[model samples]
Target: MSVGTTQTRQGLGSRLAALSRIVELGPGRVDPKLLTESGQLLLRAGDRLKLSADHTVVALAGGTGSGKSTLFNSISGLELSPTGVRRPTTARAHACVWGLDGAGPLLDWLQIQWRHRFARASALDKGESRLHGLILLDLPDHDSIRALTDTEADRLIQVADLVVWVLDPQKYADASTHRRYVTELAGHEAVTIFVLNQADRLSPEELAECVADLNDLLRREGVEDPVIVTTSATTGEGVDELKTVLADTVARRRAAVQRLEADLDRLTLRLAKAMPDSGAPVPLSSIDDARRIGLTDALCDAVGVPAVGEAMENVYGVRSVEWVGWPYSRWAAKLRPDPLNSLRLGDLRDEIKGLTGGSVSAQAAEVDTAVRALSDGLTVGMHEAWQNGIRDAARSRSAELPQLLSDELSEVAPRLDRVPGWWRLLLVWQYLLVLLFLAGVAWLGTALAYGVFGAGSLPAGLAVFGEAASLPWVGLMVLSVLGLGLLTAVASRNFVMLGAGNERDRLEREMRRRVGTVASAMVIEPVERELARYNEFYSALRGVRG
Candidate 1:
């Protein structure tokens, strides 16, 4: 092969590779039937490329009584394909292979019977040298009585590198021929040729008119500048012209590649039509600020964020009372129920499972609605297949969501568990005040008992000036201690209430952050990745189209 030919082959190989990538990524985003057909074409093209680039397969197809077999023999210089006027003369396809050394695999790929295959290359025949490297197939008549023959003809026409439609004067304008083959194969003009066989039956002017009519018909069927050659098998008229066309096609060795390229072009266009109108990718923020906030709030509600924060506040209040409340009333704090344990928030995995699997929580339903809303927002104006694909991506990890959320909350739970050091110091201060109150009670009891059961005056040792003034002073000390203890308890209650409120706010913020992470992993990120895949598939499809 020349450098230009090698380069062309390389370019075709790259396009095929891109097409393969599209097929691999197209399962949910493209039509399944279209993808399946494209995949089959790729495999067929690969097998054809590997088998033979040196030889070209040209098939002659026509209706019954069109002299298709006679034209096949005239071009091959051998009576290889049988010719007869029987209703269904040729039952099977015949191959007159010029270079048969490496054509067995290709003919097998074409599904040609081995008995119908014949060799044309001979050193003694110089005239046959020009046709070397050509595999000429004489297909069964398409309008034959037997349906099987028509099927064989259609199959061979598709597999052949180039097709020569042999049209006699009688069936040149056959409706079935035009509808079934010519119109359908319109885009294959690059690798197609038309031959008006049995031209000896028509006068020179009549033949010209027939050829012009056929050209007009083909052009109407979207075949531009149709190559129609007039020929006669008995007189060998215009046979050389058809031979020259075949020889040149064989020499270029590009018919097979070109045929495959045409197939790719047709398939890619079909696939492209199934794609979404917009090719731009959706970003992560496709879930806009309002949508993000909505999703987060829904997720928070589903995971019981408000419940958890409220529980944290209540727990803080109970714990504060245990540490800083008056020692006499500390037991009452333990009687109040622990808010965290009531909601099963401590066992987050179980809570997550309940939220996701059970239908009782209205908040879980809100979560579902929010997630679906996000998917719908991103998939607007997309093809049905693509919309379904992106929606699937958004929920791809839905089963793992419960566990993921559980993990996140578990991490934040530790932060809420930490106890502040200042609470212990306040507990010490309360104990000191209790001790002072106890001492005052003891001193007053002594003064009261001495004044009631013993002498009328107080004891000198306990007196302030060894006189009755000690009685008033002792009573004053008791009142001061009682007032101070009440004031400290009041201050501690106020401090605990303030701290609990602050802790509730902190817990809420942290829970929102964790819920957001789970939302992103479970819904947002997957949707974004799917959009990215769509863009890749679109770019690869363009490469295949070229």
Candidate 2:
């Protein structure tokens, strides 16, 4: 599709509006300060567009002594400005609208109170319709005495779809002009024309040399292919060529948008580079397992139930059996509640809460610290593994792999605290209770009945009950108590192993999560941030180019 048709159909004003909304959504996403300045400049320029079905505005701009007004007069075939040998000739901007019905809206949009309209002299020589809606602006020098004049020139330069930058032979290589304006506007260089005006003053050789020099300078300034036209208002050299270029530019409506889109694309590419690659899965390790097991073991200890079953039975073995044999055993069991069987996960959770501190924030901090440590350790381990793998792989390639691995491991290792003493105590208690309860059950049954269901009198039953009640004389009772103690010691050892195993598994999971978080923060987040920064920088660079 033709550029003009696309631009006419898809309003630049609407695009600017959408961009404004996007900027609002993430104020800091694109560097609000830079975006704000850029947006303001772009929107202001967009607002000044003199929309027409068939016309394009081309504006000329430059610093004082750049001969912009002289160029304007040469192109329009009319004396548009009062020119002199003085540095600042035009104080106010002048517009020459050709073959347009009225200049009311156009002039109003440009904020121009003075305008001159012209038509071709004859039908046969009619270039009027071809130049229909064309408004040629002779703006005041951008480096003018009046700040407002310079401001207006800048605004016009931004608004004009095509810009003709008039440069004198001497000032063409001005550092301020090149650095502050030319280099910055790399993105918009396509829509820009760098004309070395006052070319008639230079000798043929000097003119050629000057043009070559300027072209080389522009290339260095990042204008890949800049058009350098030599012109003189005195001789009108290259005037016709300049006119033809302008007319063609006007005909191709897509030029401006295409230039702008290219600039945006360049910025997008830079942004993509700044973004980090999403590869490599976060790894899991054993240290994380240890921390989790330690925490759980600590929790079990705090709940006073590392060996809950044995502890409960040891503490109330006789009572438990009496209650079990009673006619109301079912109700007794429900009311009294065996501590081990009646154990609530909530209670254990609460104990964990207490150990970590009752506050969610506190627990979160503890968990975070523990998890972070584990993650760091895993990262270190992974780095070491990578180093070893690299060395093994590069045995056929290089010798620096081991050193690289060491460096990587050092980078990843996390600072760790010694396991808390309470954790060990908890593990010990957990085992002791389990053994005590198990032994108590065995001892109680043996001590209470020698054989299963033997013929017995009330005296015999009373004797058995009496003996069960006595702690010293009854052999079964003495043995059961001794067994309970022994079981406590034995069970405590097993509970420690079980607690360690459980903690290790939990820690492994926690460590994996921590590793993932670290990877996201260290790798992914930095990339995203860099991408955003580059995008904004590119946008600004492109804006200057234009």
Candidate 3:
């Protein structure tokens, strides 16, 4: 990963951490896969750079015959490789260490062990004496027969703290080199340098004109005031100045650290863009919530709790008794039962579940469908939003990304909305109702027998009826009827509670799934898309810079 990419990753990682914290407090947890993808990408980018506190490795990059090796030799005062007129030379990379006591640590970090060392000549060379930390690399020809050499060059550039791109007057405007490397390194302009090598080959006036043209091209590629150095290995012209620049870069150890930090900063900005705005967290418009609430409401309407209450009153109205102490007058008092006690709300759960289709699996399926529909709607809305932004951005030169995002998002909408299976609340309610009905019947029978039989006339062996008869039979019958009604009401309330509870749980699951879909579409997927775009843009940018 290059510094720009590394920076982008760090930014994304921070935002993901923030999102993870938010999810912890949310009603549902985010999917592990989503979290893992976000974390792993950033980690991988960070790992590639071998970032540390102490050192920075700068790479020298250029096309064939760009005089990169000659420049490298001049900078470190070491003839590490042969530099001559050849179509393709420097088949391998050469590293030169200046003034550094040990090459082991720096080379080890750069994954390069075969390097040449140059010691300072004198104290008068003090301006260049501290070249110990400077590691000058002579990379293979980028436009050569060996494709792997080019790949290696790219890899080295990504790992290097700073890059010095060499270019000669003749091929300065070469399309392949500029399009492939210069434009792509836009964000790292501070850590990048473009050297107009072989300046000695041209007259002073010609050199000045070439340099001017090159600077203008760089500016167009998004590099503002790029450091343009003139150098000639053949004449030793500007060689000392280049050395001074390298020495200065070494003295400021912060350059490498700053380069890495800048990478992190840029990555952070990209990741921030990927994340949803923090103001008002978007509530999930999931199908599960919609389905659960919709289906529950529909089932309730179907079951008719009020109608059940009315029916119970009509059927059991004759069971109530009044004036418990006036036992003899009980027969004359017309008995009436409070219908509320017989209304079994518990029975409604099973009925509702059956009517809606039973089991959690079925309910889950239904919820999935509802969720899919909601997702589809959301995708359409997002597509419109993306398209609108793209058009607006295109019209305003202020927009950074093209309308490609809108088209890409629109293409992914269908996949995101794919729905999956249903689960039901009626089964639980039915079971509760059955239990309540049985208990009611038993209580009714006991009340009747004790009221008619008299406690004293009961057989001596059957003491169970003693308490049953001792209490005013009529009053007890009235109380028994009331108790049965209460039992039914309680059962009804329990049915509603259990059903609602199940629905809430399903809603939570659906909400999580919905969030995962959205996150994947908006963040992970977009990151991948942007990565490709960045590569293309960077390649073009580098070309122009060269």
Candidate 4:
């Protein structure tokens, strides 16, 4: 073989390796039939390559009454394959081997029995040695009345190293033959040959026209640079030229590999046609911030995050009032319900521990909507099979979603119970103001009782001042004390509520962060994994085509 041809075969070997990778990665995302057929072809090609690179199995395939058997006998120089006036003479495949060495395994692989096998070369037949190592097969007629013959012909045609289509003048332009077999096998031009049998039946002028017309049809059908040989099987015209073609093909010992390369090309083309025409997908290793936020928000809706955050705020505000409100009126704050208790969030550790089969506060419809939205966005412009495969991947972890979300809620629960250290300080200060007010009230009441009843003089410490001045100063002191206490209470209310609002914001942030983790594990990671698989499959298919 030439260096260029050797390089081509090496390239084909790489392509076969790529095809094998594709089969490994293409279960759910590809048609099962395509995968099965591709896998079988690869196995068959590997087996053939390992058997005998020295022997080239060339199958002569044609429709009924195409003189295919006559050409086979003429080339073999023996009547191994029967010829008759019957409509379908070649009912079964017959193999003619030029050299018998190492041909047993190949014939066995081809499923040709011993009765149908013939050897053309021997010590006495030196002239036939030129075509040594050639295994010629006369396949059953493709258009025979029996379905078995058609199936057998197709089966042999696919596995043959080279296929020489026998076409006679009367049926050369048969539309069914061209459409069903000739055009469909367009990629195998390297391992294909055409024989115009019974060419002597037409005049020379007619023969030239027939050849030209056939060439034109082949070109229109996308068969490029095809090799055609003219021969009259009955008269033995051009039989030597056919032998020369066979000898040259067998000499190179590259037909088998070339045939496999063309097979890969055809299979990859089918894959390419079945795939979406969309451009290369944008690589996504992880979810972007926008998508992350969207997912988090959706999950929050599904799990009632807003309601929980509001409840935390209400609980904070209620507890703040009970701790720091006007001491005498703080009793009223205790009458209100604890929002956290109502939501079963007051003791989340116990709740989680007791959960045997408890679900999260997630809504089924909302979760479905969120997951569908995510899958749809990720799989835009993909093929339906691919889209379904990715969607299924995204939901692969769905059965664990309830438990995962429950864990998130449990994780964020302790944070809600946390109270600021400053709240205690404010509580102490409020009580101090109340104490001063009560002491002032008691002193004013004692002086007023003594002055109004005139039962006794003021206490000794107060004797230095006149009665009017003492009474007025004591009343003013009481009023001033009460005013200060009232002012303190009013001012502290805003600060307490502000603290409560901050706690609400913190709770919401923590919950969102936890929910984001669940979203990633439950949806984003699996979807990205499937997309990566698809990209790998696509790349491998491209390698196969190359």
lDDT of candidate 2 over 24-125, digit per residue (tens): 533433445545654664554454433453456677878888878878877776676778898688877787776656556656777876443333333235
Query: Candidate 1's residue-wise lDDT over 423-495, tens digit each?
Result: 7887788788778778767766665666544545545665533333456776787677667766777788788
For residues 288-336, what per-residue lDDT tens digits would candidate 3 score against the true structure?
3453344333222222322323222322221221211122223344343
lDDT of each: 0.77, 0.53, 0.52, 0.80
Q: With candidate 3 superimposed using the best TM-score fit, by how many Å does residue 455's alpha carbon deviate from the native?
A: 44
TM-scores for all predictions: 0.81, 0.53, 0.51, 0.85
What 10-residue stretch in candidate 1 is worst by lDDT?
Answer: 353-362
Better of 1 and 2 by lDDT: 1
**Tens digits of per-residue lDDT for model 4, 1-546:** 568667877787788888898899988778899999889988987898779877999999998888999899888878888899987888789999988999999999999979999888752365487788999999998888873534888889989999999999999889878988999889899999999989889999999999998999898898998889999999999889988998999988889988998888888889999884476354646656787788789989888777666655655555566666677667654565542343355555343323312224676668777888888887788888878988898778776785678677766654444557877887788778778777767666665666555657865886533243466777687677667766766677778777667866887788888888888888888888887887778778778878
lDDT of 3: 0.52
Clash counts for the predictions, in order: 0, 21, 49, 0
Best candidate according to TM-score: 4
Ranking by lDDT: 4, 1, 2, 3
The residue ranges of model 1 lying beyond 4 angstroms of the native Cα positions read 203-208, 283-298, 318-363, 403-428, 431-455, 459-529
Q: Write the number of the candidate with greater lDDT, choosing between 1 and 4.
A: 4
